[model samples]
Target: MELKKNPKANVGRNSSLYFAVGLNVMLLLTYLGLEHKTYETETVKADILMMTEQLEEDIPITTINIPPPPPPPKQLVTEVITVVEDVEEVEETFVESSEVGQDDIIEERVVSVEEVEVVEVEEDVEVPFAVIERVPQFPGCKGNNAELKACFQEKMQEHLQKHFRYPPTAAELDIQGKVFVFFLIDKYGKVAKIQTRGPNELLETEAERIISLLPKMEPGKQRNKPVGVPYSIPINFKLQEQ
Candidate 1:
């Protein structure tokens, strides 16, 4: 009546059921532990965020005072002047007497107003342009009247071409025009009285900058006397198509 199979053979059949139950129990415990830890971490994060949001509630609002800007200064206004033509010329003569007499009383004579220097306000004075007698010599220009004048013109043109620059703003806006600049070569051959007329102020500014870079040169002369020579040249600002 006892079992015919070995006892260990039946024991192996129950071993599989025991292993499956233990593995399922272990997995369930690991899942529960991970869920507990995740809940604790979320609780801590929520508390930190809530504390940050409530922190501003306990603080008081503040106001600051700002100063106002200063007032603008007043501008001076000049009076307009009217010009008049000269119609009369008076001559003044200064005569000294050499005869001295003790009985003679020297009477004072009214002096003529012609000897006095009268200054008139002028808007613009036309400076002379030097010609054959003597002409303005640009730096590095040498030779006779014809040679010097030709060299000067060549150098000036070269200078303008070398320093030609197109304003970035003007280029971006696609505006191109010719600028005419008038500058004076004074008695000392120094550039002065620079004036520019152009379609745009930016173009004029560049033209003036090119002329201002001129080196000190031999002054222009008229009848062997140093004089101011007004010179004018045109500069073209053009942008090429891409």
Candidate 2:
């Protein structure tokens, strides 16, 4: 029973106070140990005011005499012109009023009609190859539907094969590309408006030249009327490895 002494006394009551004191001390130490930011003091240097001597300007009062403006020029007087009537007197003939018989009455002078030239305007209508009633014919394409189309294609291929000249620069540089050419056959059976698209400019130029050299063919007809035909074809420019 003697070993258990002060059992009813509170031991943990002062521990909180000690912890608070320790925490405050640690905070104070931390605050002291941290690098403090220094602010530079604003230096207000008093500048001595130098009195500058002011130059006195003597103002001279001068009176200027302005001449009066000249009077305006007198206007020209116009003479009154008297208008004299130059009427030629026609002799008065008294004719008694009588019945206007067709044979006795004088006929009024008739005005002749003036002739004018009539101008005619012609516009070429464009039609596609697939939809036109009568397809365009090449030089030697004289046949019906399927045969005509086949003959046209055959003639076109033959023409290409004959006129297809590879550009010297393209062959020299080994440049190869496919050029798409779009040409129009006018109503007069003349090839016009040739355009080309390709990877190379030289290739495009060559294709356009070949297309432009195409001979005049019979203009395509739609509903038995001649029309312009828009045809597009692709030509390949390939360099052979020799």
Candidate 3:
């Protein structure tokens, strides 16, 4: 015995359609809610002021006293011109042509070497210390080229140590740096043309002074001839830590 149910009474048959309809209605409601706008009424404040009568007062007119325009700048004769006769006559100078014409006589004479004055100009030649064949010999320094160079340096150091005096102001102000002293040992073995560069002028001056105290030495030679030798040394101005 099988029993048959009515197809129109099935509940789950329209469930999908009902869900789609409900979802569409929820989306429409959400859109409407989001798009809803409310307007608020604001009360305006009014201030009323009463009119008052204004009184008019007359302002006094004041006159400014100005000095009558400086008496027009007085007119006066500043200069007077007078004609004077010429007293002294100026001699007229005649310019002669320097170009030689065919009529001008030219004297020809033979020149002899003995009659010609030969001026021997001593050339001032400079050679660097490192490349010079013979380095400048310090006082009491005698040796070959290399030994002389070493001795010269040793003597220079001794001279600097003997005369090294720090400027009191520089030491007090705490100025310390290395000063490069460049000096030329002239062909006559005299230290000359001393130049210095340093962080401060005081240090440079002191370095210059120390180099100036060096004794006259034998000039450096290049190719068996004395030449001015340029030497550079650095003097360090350092203060001892307390």
Tens-digit per-residue lDDT, 1-242, candidate 3: 99899988899998999999999999999999999999998999999986697788999999999878666777887897999999989999999999999999999989998998988998999999999999998888887999999999898899889999999999999999999999999999999999999999999999999999888988999999999999999999999998
TM-score of each: 0.48, 0.51, 0.56
Candidate 1 lDDT, 103-141, residue by residue in tens: 888998888999889998743333455443567887777
What is the Å distance of residue 3 in model 3 from its true position?
A: 85
Q: Which 10 successive residues of model 2 have the least lDDT summed? A: 109-118
- Candidates 1 and 3 compared: the better one by TM-score is 3
Question: What lDDT does candidate 2 reach at residue 87?
Answer: 100
Candidate 2 lDDT tens digits, 177-234: 8999998988888889998999999999999888888898888888889999899999
CA lDDT scores, all candidates in order: 0.82, 0.88, 0.94
Model 2, which residues run further than 4 Å from truth? 1-121
Each model's number of backbone clashes? 0, 0, 0
Task: Output the number of the TM-score-best candidate.
Answer: 3
What does each candidate score in C-alpha RMSD?
26.3, 10.8, 7.6
Return the clash pairs for model 2, or none. none
Q: For model 3, which pairs clash?
A: none
Which residues of candidate 3, in runs, are more than 4 Å off?
1-102, 110-114
Candidate 2 TM-score over all chains jointly = 0.51
